[model samples]
Target: MKAYILQKDSQSLDNLCLIERPDPVPGPGQLLVRMRAASINYRDQAIVTGGYFGGRVKRDTIPLSDGAGEVVAVGPGVSRFKVGDRVAGTFFLGWVDGPPVGRRTARGAPADGVLAELVVLDEIDAVALPPHLSFEEGACLPCAGLTAWHAVVEACRVRPGDTVLIQGTGGVSLFALQFARASGARVIGISSSDEKLERARRLGLETGINYRRTPEWGDEVQKLTGGRGVDHVIEVGGAGTLARSMQALAFGGRIALIGVLSGHQGDTNPHPLVMKGGSMHGVVVGNRAMFERMNRAIEINGIRPVIDRVFPFAEARAAYEYQQSGALFGKVVIAI
Candidate 1:
């Protein structure tokens, strides 16, 4: 098997070396998958740069958690999946059901991730990809898509006629827009680039605010809602934009804090939270059960994940670099 191995001392993409390794066998209740595609997430970049989750790396690691592949073999007692089944790897392998908290259920840390020719996943940790999605699209579903689904559908419980604000056009934000729109909710997208905002409009976003042009974008959000703030805000910018998100929320509005793309540290006054009686929920990526339910909705609604580009497996480093550029409107993938 050929795998990209990160050298211990080098925290650069140049340190990622494609090397030959012995093929791994499935353990009990595990399934061996021949990977077809893997997608990059913000976490993948942090891991590559040695800045994620307290910068922990016990061994040389293979990067990326979200991938889709065909099952090649199954270990004993793996009755749920058989050879030739097309499945997507679960981002949180330890979390099969219920809500996720802390770092206990995270995937792609010390564990070998999916940037390889083959991977062995616990049978219960993989979800069958929707028959309607391609391997590349399925690769995007596990992390970014599932996170948005969990926040909008499961956590916030956004309803029809509710107005939701999604910041930026990154993978999670774009998925949030698509999912919210499919649920019959109104969507407002915020972006720093007008070109990207136009692209988002083509994707069915009815309103867009260029944050760079409109420094007081929160006020615009309020205006769009006719003096009331939006019902929900997918706060991907975290602390850097938390105050603005606060200003853009209606009374009792919910903000799903999904990422810290903008620097992690900032101060926020408690008065708005108290006065508006709104809530902010920290969303980790979802569990296996949520991923399964999301897939069903995707198949039923015929929603397709927005893929910015696909890179060959050997160009995984280039793929990561492209994602870091912040010019992409959707997920970047590596075809394995």
Candidate 2:
């Protein structure tokens, strides 16, 4: 089997080397997956460049947290799936169904990820993919998709008549837009490009603000909503845009802090949220239970994940480069 591995001493795309390795066999309660596709996330970039919270890995590791494949074999006691079952691995291998356990291990950095032809996943940490989704689409679900679901559906509980402020057209935000729309929420999106904004409009975005042109998008939000402000915010910009996010919140609204795309250094105030009775929740990619629920929702709503491009597995490096190029409006996938 051929797999890409990141060396501990070399943490850059230039160093992501693909090599042949022996096929791995699953142990008790595990499934040996023949990965068909994998998706890149912002976190994967951070891991590749040694900027993730844990720093450089202590050992060579496969990269990418999100992937989908068919079960080639199932270990003893693996009742959750069988050979030929389609599945996707969870982000956190151990935190299955409860409040996060301490320092939970995750894929693509602290542990071996799915950037390989074959990988082993615990039965408890893998979820069945929706039958309607292709492997490339399933690869988009484990991270960006689940995180968006956790924010729009779980944290904010966006409902019909509510307004959701999506930050950008990246993987998570686009997924949030789709989920919020499916839940009957009015979705507003902000992007640096008018073209991206226009594209978002086709995805049920009720309004689109070119934040580069309208720097005070919060004011625009207020105007769009007739001074009521948005009921929910998918806050991916972190401290850089957090003040504006607070200004755009409706009374008793909620903000789910998902990423810090804008560097984390900025002066941010919390008073506006306080005044608006707004609450903020930090969103990490969700657990297995949430993944299952999200899959069901995708199936029920007939939601298909937006893929900006799909690369052959041999072009995984090109996939990473494209994801980092800031030209993508949705997920970047590698077809294994």
TM-scores for all candidates: the values are 0.97, 0.99
Q: For model 1, give the RMSD to the true fold.
A: 1.2
Model 1's alpha-carbon lDDT is 0.90
**Residue pairs in collision within model 1:** none
Which regions of candidate 1 deviate over 4 angstroms?
Answer: none
Backbone clashes in model 1: 0
Segments of candidate 2 deviating more than 4 angstroms? none
lDDT of 2 by residue, 1-46 (tens): 9999988855788879999999999999999999999999999998
- Best model per TM-score: 2
Cα shift from native, residue 182, model 1 (Å): 0.9
174-214: candidate 1 lDDT, tens digit per residue: 99999999889999989999999999998889899999999
